[model samples]
Target: MNNDLYQEDIKQIKQQYACLDLTDDQAAFLLRHQNEPYPTHTEYYLNTWEHHDYEDHIFQKILNTAQFDHYLERREARLATHIAFLKQQDEEIKRNIEYKKQLLSYYCHTYVPQLLQTRLQYPNPFFAHRSKIRYIKEEYSNCCKVWKLRVTSQHFRNCRNYSPQLFELHMLDLQLLNIMPDYQQFKADADMPTQTTLTFLLDKSRCYLADFISFFDQKEAEETRTKKDAAIAVFGKAATSGWHIEPLPESNEERSNRLLFLLLMIEKVPDNGQANSCY
Candidate 1:
């Protein structure tokens, strides 16, 4: 073998020996014999030590040390690069988390509300029942009442989900989905004495929308029950009659818009020409 290659092999053997559980004196003895050439086994090294050539052994020691130092330099360089990469990854993860929080805030405060208000201005044909329209308005109002009670960032974050802005968008989407054939049927029924009774029923149904808003509140179970009972009182026996109550949409974007619209309706007051007065 080439001298360099022989030195490298000897360095590897020394490293392996260093990892063993030897006492200091035993290690010193092992190191002293490292450069001595013997047969390939430990038994031969121990048997031949007395007759080993000193000049040849000292030459092997120099080559072994040089090879060991080269290996050490390479290991140190690799470790440094690995540590630097890990730190960069940690910082990137932190930045991504902050960006996500900011995005959620913007959706809650600005984007969702604008979308809801715009959709609410244009009434959907699917909700042609005047009563259903009135119910939508009342539910919107209830959402606003609930929002006003939110106190903390966590509360605000949760309340933001039920904002009327989100609700309005969802309502529009549902209308597009054509999920309101039964509601349309009720609107088409002309045999009823006047549209007033239908309008009254619609208002009663609208009251149940409060339950949906209340669900996001801290006191969700209590408020939901209270609002549900109140809605039943308005509906009376008709509440038990199996009129189709449109299921709430599952999408976060749709639900938020729907809730926002409900809040807007809750906050609005009809003008009685009384300056700055709200009931």
Candidate 2:
């Protein structure tokens, strides 16, 4: 055969022998002596006797056993690295959540109480009235920002009376209502008929007379209350319907009366129409 054909045949033979369990030196020897004739069977056995000598062989086996061990080690190392990364991320998330919770608790326990106490001590009726409206405006603004952040079209909504103006107006209304008995006696002696009954008059009338405007509307007090009631009816379908009633003490103590009056004023209105006219 030509040199090219001979080379091709040798390549194929080497490929076949590559599948055998032969050592590097043995495969090299076979490739080098491929063109030589085989010796007699007895002489061949004697010449290659060293390969059979397992304990004192010159050439080692070239099996792929260690490759599997190497692959297993790599896999184990990769898994260990991945597990460590997950653990680190989990710990960081937990720490961040705990920090946020502590911050919220601090605000609720300390900041809110201090703010309420300060307002109580100062008792600026005008400022308190204005502050309620400002508070509602800020809350609504915050809700709008939240809606934007959440990428939602729905408007942020709240029913809680956060406005300082409204709060002060309610306080004033409560004070007036508590002194109604005295006002009635004075009016009776002066021979005058009151335009409205104290218990039947809506708190919104007081809000209107005192120039309290809703954050959403700057309309007259009667109109504002009408719109508010309508809105509440529509949106507050899922809201709770119960009066936060607290009994007034049977004492003429000024502090007790003031405390009780304030408590009654701060009590939330029920969802239904019953007692809705009261502050």
Candidate 3:
């Protein structure tokens, strides 16, 4: 409710959404609808994008969150209902966690102790106490922020390492995660022009997002065609189809950013191979 704090949080929201290449109209939509959930940072979207490392901010907001989290959630606005729904999910998870803590602690002290004593064996102190402690410890493990992270292993090469005004490949996964919904919306609507990465909008020289993505797309296509053509030319099937893409090259970290989004795109797909980029 404090006007000063409200404005400051709004600044954070704007900064977080700045990575996307939005069209004039899409930009206006976000500009008008920017006043929803108040997050200290946008990294949370990285996890929600199915990278499995979602434990970042939810716990901090909900751990000591009994009174405090609700206090912030009470701040009202004519927000995008989707964002509000996410906030509500956070609240529900928080309540469930708090309830689990209470229930686990209560059973750890009371009926569980009595149940252990009931066992006719000499003594089950390990089951009654130590095992219980271990179970509780494992239970709390689920409360962690880092669930499963697979992207740290992957890497990619791009044109430029340093682009201040534009979103680059190294940072694409983070911003792209947030705009996946907008990407779908763009497909359903006719006014938006199709960009390679969907939600991404292009600017002057900041990073021609469509061209950049297509460059990789076409390059991969050529390589696939090249190897397959060679293989089919010889016999029924080639011994190796994708051996050329191997032999990874190294680059400067400070000046270069890997196209982590490629890995992220694969991550979104189902292991059963039933879906094309799970989106």
Per-prediction CA RMSD (Å): 26.4, 32.0, 26.9
Q: Which candidate is the best by lDDT?
A: 1
lDDT of the candidates, in the order given = 0.39, 0.35, 0.33
Model 3, 1-279: lDDT tens digits are 676775555565446534332334433444444445656663433332232123224323333445334423532231234345644544444432432333333333432333334322323322334343333223222211111122222221111212221222222332233222122222343232233322221121114233344444554455455445544543335344444323244453311123322211212213322222212
Evaluate residue 268 in candidate 2 and report its C-alpha lDDT on the 0 to 100 scale.
Answer: 25
How well does each candidate superpose onto the true structure, as a TM-score? 0.19, 0.21, 0.18
Order of candidate numbers by TM-score, starting with the best? 2, 1, 3
Per-candidate count of clashing residue pairs (backbone under 3 Å): 22, 6, 2
- Sort by lDDT, best first: 1, 2, 3
| Superposed model 3: Cα runs more than 4 Å off | 1-81, 123-279
Superpose all Cα atoms of candidate 3 onto the true structure and report the RMSD in Å to 1 decimal.
26.9
Q: What is the per-residue lDDT of model 2 for residues 158-275, given as tens digits with 9 covering 90 to 100?
A: 1122223333333333322322212222223221222122222223223332222131123223333443343344435332222211222345333233332232233222332112
Tell me the deviation in Å of residue 224 in model 3. Answer: 60
Clash pairs (backbone) in predicted model 2: 129-165, 131-164, 132-163, 132-164, 132-165, 133-165
Q: Which model is ahead, 1 or 2, in terms of TM-score?
A: 2
Worst-scoring 10-residue span by lDDT in model 3? 156-165
